[model samples]
Target: MLVNAIWDFDGTLYDSYPGMMKALAALVTANGGQIEPKTLYRQVKETSIKQFLTGFGQQVGRSVADLEADYHQRARAYLQDIHPYPEALAVLKAIKAQGGHNLLLTHRDRSAWEILAHDQADTLFLGGVDADLKLPRKPAPDAIQYLLRRFQLNPAVTAMIGDRSLDVDAGINADVKTIYFNVDGLNAAPQADYQVDHLIEIPPLFRK
Candidate 1:
């Protein structure tokens, strides 16, 4: 049975991309640049917020820090609209019921806690690593390594569940099982150890 599950917060657990897209759109418009929403979505999903913001800043002759500041402020408004994915909470509950502990590891900053708290999902996590920690981002494995060491978790029976390649890479780097949550049919990371279409399908795999 899986004894420890590390979760990704944004697209993995919460439907946050729409809110994130809104924030990015507002930032681009404020900079007097027009963006194609689908293109922006694809770019962000394939790369990252930092990469996209940095590239956009360079294109529009703005500083990345300035754009990030404005974008984060805009994101706060939309964060309230973000919610847990259908059956996401149920999966977390199931993990806990199986005597496993659920933890969070996300690129989002402390604001991630806000969303979890809002949805009353914060209690499901034993702890987390967020951007506020100033740790290296996904694919680096620094954050996941820290979590494993700090929690005294064994990687063999632990799993990292996420919606992106970086998340799977982090898990691989940390020597843990990787579960790719490909609900969007994106098929982005076929290299993951396991892939699933729905959150409801998860708990059974770890059942004792």
Candidate 2:
């Protein structure tokens, strides 16, 4: 009876971390700070983009905002390489076919929709809240609350799927079930209603 599925963009529906990591690597190099790809990935994955940028800024004698501005500008080139996770579209279509409304909840702005549109996946979503809306970021539940009210989604029948702990935390705060897309095998699991390593495993959870 899961009638609504709220998805996270990067690392969840789309394999965007590679592009984002490349952009960060290039940014670090341009700022005369060296970072290995694996090291950069681990740091960003374990912490977050903002945390990574904060430390990078200090190392390069720049402000976080300045560093982020530069990173976003550089990211555009790399981001074009982004694509959906394997079976991600299939899972989305399955949800839709089962009469479930798929929605996006992400910190990314228009670029997220642009990416989904390129794959024609944008049409599957009922609606979403993006960063441009200026809602409090995930783990806050403000954006998810807005979606619940606007879409008349029942929290009991809504599930939030995301790759990060904050995403699960936001879903919990919003009073919905959470599915943690644990692409990497973390020893300590987030307290999600369900956990899966692949997109193909998702649709079964929502089946009647």
TM-score of each: 0.95, 0.93
Tens digit of lDDT per residue, candidate 2, span 1-208?
Answer: 5789999998889988888988898899888889789888877766678789998888879999899889889889877789998899999999999878899998888999999999999999999999899999878899999999999999998998898888888999999999998887662236999999888888877755
Best by TM-score: 1
Whole-model Cα lDDT of every candidate shown, in order = 0.89, 0.88
Candidate No. with top lDDT:
1
lDDT of 1: 0.89
TM-score of 2: 0.93
Question: Candidate 2 regions off by >4 Å?
Answer: none
Count of backbone clashes, every candidate in sequence: 0, 0
Error of 1 at 175 (Å): 1.7
